[model samples]
Target chain A: MPLEAPVEVMLAASAGNVLVWVVWVVAALALLSSGIAVVLFTNPFYSALSLIGNLASLAVLYLLLSGEFVAGAQVIVYAGAIVIMFVFVLAYLGGRADAPWAGGPTLQAAAAVVAAAAIALEVIVVIALAAGDQLSDTAEVTGAFGSPAEIGDLFLSDHLLAFEATSIVLLVAAVGGVILGSAMPQRSKAGAD
Target chain B: MLGPGIAAYLILSVVLFATGAFGVLIRRSPLIILLALELMLNAGNLALIAFSRQLGNGDGQIFALTVMVVAAAEAVLGLGLIVAVSRKRVELDVDKLTTLSG
Candidate 1:
């Protein structure tokens, strides 16, 4: 009873409360704005940059979730490698900015909006229902939840097959990329010369 | 510390996912579409990590890592295909790709 009192008091402290709220608000805004920019920007390059910003903010959010390894991987893999690949393709396919949204099929757009809204409503209801629930004893969080060692143990023990299979898939993708890139007649001609 | 609760994280994930879906629906460029897809994937990752932390489980984080790898490979192949296709034709718009038309 005494330990619970102090724990609750600590969580209620003004400094920690304000700091968490501030970080959460800033990260959330950055995530939302960058996601919008990624979609709305006319230039592909700008969209790629916005996507990078979104990914970086998402990494920060992951850190807030106490997923340290996931945060790092998000920055390194998504922001660094994937964005670079996107930029490379954008640069290679030089062109004018895409045509302004001329309002594609109205039915498709309406369906998309309805589907997205339905999903959002469903999530909100689920969150409301789960708001009062607490983690089970077996799932009680420790400081090591996202530590590298914990992740490694999980990967090696439970996810070993998946981990190995991902390697194979990546290898195939790499070879496929090479074939697809070289298969272009223009690329082949340039290579021959 | 009074950290943001699971509901906050879930709300953010929902918004992000919705934005990505809207982007995919509204945008015409293939590159932009791909970027939107990435946004959706990241949103899913966020939800997974949030639940993982709530449950004190490492499995979700590992799964997110696997998702990232798969996403990377998908981006590589997708961009490669885009490059090859663009070389043959000038338009990179997705609507014009009616190759499957009967």
Candidate 2:
């Protein structure tokens, strides 16, 4: 009775509980389908578009979980910025790029399937075992839970070093990107000389 | 309070991670590989945020933000490398374009 109390109360108290369930179903379905589409589609452009769909669904799920800031970042950074970069490169590469599944599953592909399956099975079993009794009811979240202000405070206080390290990482990545982008042209120039 | 519980989210994360790994392995295009990598990273982010909600705190959210920045940087550098590779090589396949140097 005690175990079921919180869940039952949550269901009864919220009129929009059904809507949340529906939204979760829809977003989860979109996430899975678009994820599959991203992998299955041969055209990189379609794959990029599919990735965008996947990102959008993930953002919606983040909203359901009260991760408003993460939801916003998922939309902006992933769907907005990263997917755009993919499209630009796809445009540059054009349609002539070689497709992957040209003939059939090679030895490598078969091995990949096996490896992925084994890892997934092991992890899932652990989750099912450990998560059975503990996570039946959700945590009692505070008013400030998942708020940007709270998370920002954590960034500047608890995780300050990590935050600064991330900025340095971004700086390095930016420099790497610029140099890498120009690398080929400089090589060709050297060849000409 | 996603209705299906935290376990559902965890299962979903596993599936997404598996799909991404499969894509990364089978796909020949560098761009698709990068896309798959994004999926994998987002899979981790999903789990982190789900736990953040479950714990009633902002720790996981902060971690998720850090992940986003890293993912962005990774995508930028990866795309740049793809562009660099495309210029010299006629075939843009990862398998074919193996060697780093001439």
True contacts kept of 1: 0.79
Best by lDDT: 2
- For residues B1-102, could you state the per-residue lDDT of candidate 2 as single tens digits? 635677778788888988899889988888889999999999999999888888777888898999999999999999998887777665777778857656
**Model 1: residues with Cα > 4 Å off, grouped in runs:** A1-13, A103-111, A126-140, A185-193
For model 1, how does the per-residue alpha-carbon lDDT over A1-193 read when each residue is reduced to its tens digit?
6779987877669777798789889999999999989988888899999998899888888887788888888898988899988888887787349743566557777777788788778877876687536522224577787978888888899999998998999999999999888855667668857
DockQ, per model, reads 0.67, 0.76
Docking class of 1: medium
Worst 10 residues of 1 chain A by lDDT: A131-140
Model 1 Cα lDDT, one tens digit per residue, B1-102 = 256777678789989998898888877788889999999999899988987887777888998999899999999999988888887665787888878687
* Model 2 chain A poorest ten-residue lDDT run: A95-104
Query: Each candidate's TM vs. the true structure?
Result: 0.87, 0.89
